[model samples]
Target: MENTKGISRARFLAGAAAVGLTGAVLPAGQAAATGRGHGHRGLKHRGVVYTVGAGETPGTAWSAARMRGDVRVIRDDLHADTIDVTGDGVERLTATAAEAAERGLHVWLQPTLGDVPEREILDGIAECGRFAELLRRQGASVDFSVGCEFWLFVPGIIPGATVLERVDNLRKGNVDMARMQRRLARFTAKAADVGRSVFHGRLSYAAAQDEEFEPVDWNLFDVVGIDYYSFFPQPADYVCELRRHLRWGKPLAITEFGTCAYVGAPETAGMGWDIVDYTKEPNEIKGDPVRSERTQAAYLVELLEVFESMGLYAAMAFEFVTADAPHRPDNPRYDLDLASYGITKAIKDRPDDPSSNWHWEPKEAFHAVARRYGRRAGPGGVTMAEEVRAWTGPLS
Candidate 1:
């Protein structure tokens, strides 16, 4: 597999490892942070926007406040059914949605069916169906981006068919164009199904060539959805590639995007920690933290500008919170202890044995995004300070 940024997957992995940063585990908190930027002023666009998950964290809420777009919440583990929507969950999500709605944000409910154990698939679908119904009863405008990145999880074909293939399989098995239309038809036919819209979630894989392109059944959706990381070389490259697959003319939404940052323990006990470096060729530490964050922010700004210029419908950043992986301790898929893509760091406070893993913390890129989109507060408002400063120097 190749990253959209022109780096082959193997090369990117090897390069990343050489820098002392390892592991690209999908941060659940990253996915959950998708909805945090929904309500800020000046962040307006014609696109159909959405966020990662609907966790009721302050960080998530703050992020949503800065986004001038629609909101979508992952409804799998968080609120899969009425039983899961306990008093706490209900209150939290409801408050979150209400806050978003007040800021002109539309909420969509998304559910995934394939990543879990095979035994859980049927239960997942059923849970999704019920979850959609329950949210509707609550008078919320609910929709489902059912079965996220199905292609990424499907078995068979090559042993390592890349992440894109796995996501494609997910869609094919559950809701491709033909299947999606049928499902929608049935869903519409049901007598009591009044308030929900169901769309297929097609997570884009990191394939740089057409030979690796996985076909999507775009005809079955009311809206088109994709997850983007810093895979492509530039935002323009991504936009061009995206335009090719957008034959159906439905609105498009980016399900994810962000830079990865790794953290490590301090070199000396009482001394301040040294940032992991990723500069050298043969195992030299040269991880460019500042560059990574700036690049991510610049890419998002450029991408959003292109979407606006092209009159594309929707786009959402990857997420809001800095989350930790629950299953990382035992997983041996990779070597590194931390995933560095989150905007915030997750750190455990202790005197001597403080966490050795990279802590997840907000980067300047996060603030840059907030400012550029008019999602922040105060006098200067939401201006692209970084870009402006880069171009104009100090504004006497």
Candidate 2:
């Protein structure tokens, strides 16, 4: 959950005092990415994750992308059991960047070089370089995340081969922080080496929100990145807790954060996505949207307040759209929408229209976030019920 567990759709890794490096070592084949053109020094990063596949996206908007977000975290060329970044995949990857660049948005390209095998990881990074070059040519501001949680997702990066196995191992107390940190440091440095060869831009990996991230030397990347989630029972202390991360002295970004759609969803904010039964049909699932969606909307407002008050560099909403569980007509029992953390709901594609495919309609949280980014709170300085209840959607 960073889908809240920092791993959902992690389908999700570690390291310790493995600290600063003497010199930035650019991985082979991508020396040019480390060149002088990189810059993202001052940016507020009002971002939304655009989960993308080849040329298709997890969700598309009804008319056009609303000006709600400034930074578009394009999840490009990522791989899982059924996903692999092939030639076509790379094209799919750059295509989203082209669209984002056209919208005048800063782009954070996260390319999942396939898990395990050294060659696959290298091949993935090379393609990311190619994609990065394509994005830069489009005049889009770009930052590169070598990988997400690699320790668990990628094979051979840690002791366990699969995510479940690794999670189990961690639970059973098999984690070796020192060994894990050393491996991650080597791998990230390697990625930097290769990444700099072609795409010269800001680079950083999306680390987990957990303490396992301690080994990473934040100084290696341009911006200190972390996929944070409100896994805690009460989010009231979020601002206070952030002091630890800000101590890194580098610009910080909440690469990921969001709450699911459900009445008691906030309690499971960190890993709600995992609680759903993906095998079920969306329409068949049913829940009280009024209570659930409102809860999600309120959660968004609370988090933004923390970000603004804390003065963090930037924060990206966990996601803009989710395709796994989309909004559909009738039925509610199997509704995947209830379990999603997307700010917008995915409406099925029009079967009759040729020009349009699908659409993502804004949730109440969308307006709430837009209001926060404007440096103002919802309606009355900041609202939970009113801001959400104002909407006329199914959830409202």
- Compared with the true structure, the alpha-carbon lDDT of candidate 1 equals 0.34
The weakest ten consecutive residues by lDDT in model 2 span 77-86
* Candidate 2, 1-396: lDDT as tens digits: 122222234234212111111111212231222111213222256666655432223233212243223223222211000111111134455655555666566777776544357667766777877686677776767777776666655666666766556666665667676887788778777776777777777776777665434356777777767766654445456654555565555666677778777676666535555455435632234435433666677777677666655555556776766644556555465456666777777666752232345656767666666655544432345444445555666442
TM-scores for all candidates: the values are 0.49, 0.71
Root-mean-square deviation of candidate 2: 9.9
Q: Best by lDDT, which number?
A: 2
Q: What would the per-residue lDDT of candidate 1 be over residues 1-396, giving only the tens digit for each residue?
A: 221111122223332233222322222221212122333322223222222333222233323333222223222211111111101122333444454433334444443322234334334444454555554565644444443433333222212244444433433442243543344334322211221232123211111112122334555555555544433435455545555435555555554444433322111110111232224321122333222344444544555555444444344443443322211223222211123333333342321222333333445444544444443222554334445465323321
**Cα miss at 174, model 2 (Å)?**
5.3
Regions of candidate 2 where Cα sits further than 4 Å from its true position = 1-43, 54-88, 133-139, 160-165, 168-177, 231-236, 278-291, 349-358, 374-396
- Report the C-alpha displacement of residue 294, candidate 1, in angstroms: 2.5
TM-score of decoy 2: 0.71
Clash counts for all predictions: 54, 34
In order, the Cα lDDT scores of the candidates are: 0.34, 0.55
